[model samples]
Target: MWRIDFFLDNGYENVSMNDIVKHAGGSLATLYKHFGNKEQLFIYILEQKSEEVFGEWGRKSVCYEGRIEEFLTETGRMFLDLVTTPDAILFHRLLISIGYINDSRLNKTQIQNLMSVPVIIIANYLENEKVNGHIEVEDTYLVAEQFLNAVKGPFLFQTILGIQIDISEETRLKALKQVVTIFCRGLHVIQ
Candidate 1:
């Protein structure tokens, strides 16, 4: 999987199956048996990468039980940081290009499942807070969405539409912290 990322990051797009197999020191027959074709191989690599990325977040969220607002603010910044990395941004651009090329194979539900990791984590944190009387959320999902929207403007624009705005680390952290603080204030029980 790392080999695939390396090749793709190194500008090997639109290459043939033969090239991939040769580059990876494997045979055509083995490549065909394992991945079928170039598209399949690329999607397979993406699937593997998505799982590795989202799975790590899931694992950390499971063990997390800190202040819900602070936790979400930090986690949101981390998520944006991951998405903004060069390799990650390139992966998204490749997917968008593929989607534009009449190939919806990359949009399979299984692959799409990887994207819901943050939503799940935020919902979990909000629900936990509600349960513990730390905050009040009538609808966890919607609150999660609102919280996301608050910290979403910069990275979401860049990821979805190639908006080339530079977001500094300090600015990103401040934005996330403000969103979480606002969310907490909005939903907290005032005495």
Candidate 2:
């Protein structure tokens, strides 16, 4: 946790194991024993952050109960809330910059696993909706990805570009409803 805080305060490249040892109260040997190197440590931190953000959402047992729209609106809000935070924005920027420098550091499998957390959660919900006969989705995974991108793309783009867009609560709620309605319609949801 200290290492993560330090890295966030100072960019990843700027921090060294010695620096972490100085502040984190661990010996160099112990640090190396836990994490092989800086890249590994950074990846570990990212995995931890991913789990913190998506773990509960991914693990919760839920059924739509014929309230798919309501579920989508609430999930969309949660997704937006998670992505729009200052820390999340900064972390995403850091990851992108790092990816450009050394793409291999962000291993494909690791990235897929991290990115799949939310998708898997939403896919499970969609599958439940399908089984309950509330919607017709030929591909739950693709639909989940599309729905997330639709709800999160515009705001995320603005955020990534450092643009400040003030959206009122009412406007945000209306937009979420519109997205959910359109998505459900696409799924051929009845009522």
Candidate 3:
């Protein structure tokens, strides 16, 4: 919690274990004991934040069992909302900026895990739909990734690059609907 706040306020590269201990009023040994190291703590913070943003969707719940379209629409909207936030953009930028630094606390595996949460959740839903014969996807992972990118790509890039400050809810919904339509049509074909 404190670590997340500290990281957000001070940036990932700027914050250190000592700073976290000082601000959090905890011992370094305790922090290390609980989180293993800075990378682990950072990953934990990411997991917590993802859960907060995505709610039960982040955990692969089967809430959309009989309604694939509803699931895609809701998940697309939520994913767009999460990634377009200023805080999310800043966090992503921070991660990308420091990702290649020598001996960086964040590593490829940790970053992949953080990125994989939504994909995994979406893939689980897709797998369920496939089982029900509602859709046919040879690779749920690829489909999930494509669906996410279609939903998040335009707005996320614009927000991250300062090209667009904010997108209207109407625009967001329309785009999401368009993507869901395209994806559903493609997946509903006889196979």
What does candidate 2's lDDT look like per residue over 31-130, in tens digits? Answer: 8999888778877877887888888776653844678887788788888788777777776776666666763454657766786788888888888889
lDDT of 2: 0.78
Model 2 misses residue 107 by how many Å? 2.2
Candidate 3 similarity to native, TM-score: 0.88
Would you list the rank order by lDDT, best first? Answer: 3, 2, 1
Clashing pairs in 3: none
TM-score of 1: 0.76
> Which model is ahead, 2 or 3, in terms of TM-score?
3
Best by TM-score: 3
Q: How do all the candidates rank in terms of TM-score, highest first?
A: 3, 2, 1
**Residue-level error in angstroms, candidate 2, position 85:** 0.5
- TM-score of each model, paired residue for residue: 0.76, 0.87, 0.88
Q: Residue 160 lDDT in model 1? A: 53
Error of 2 at 23 (Å): 3.2
Model 1 local distance difference test score: 0.68
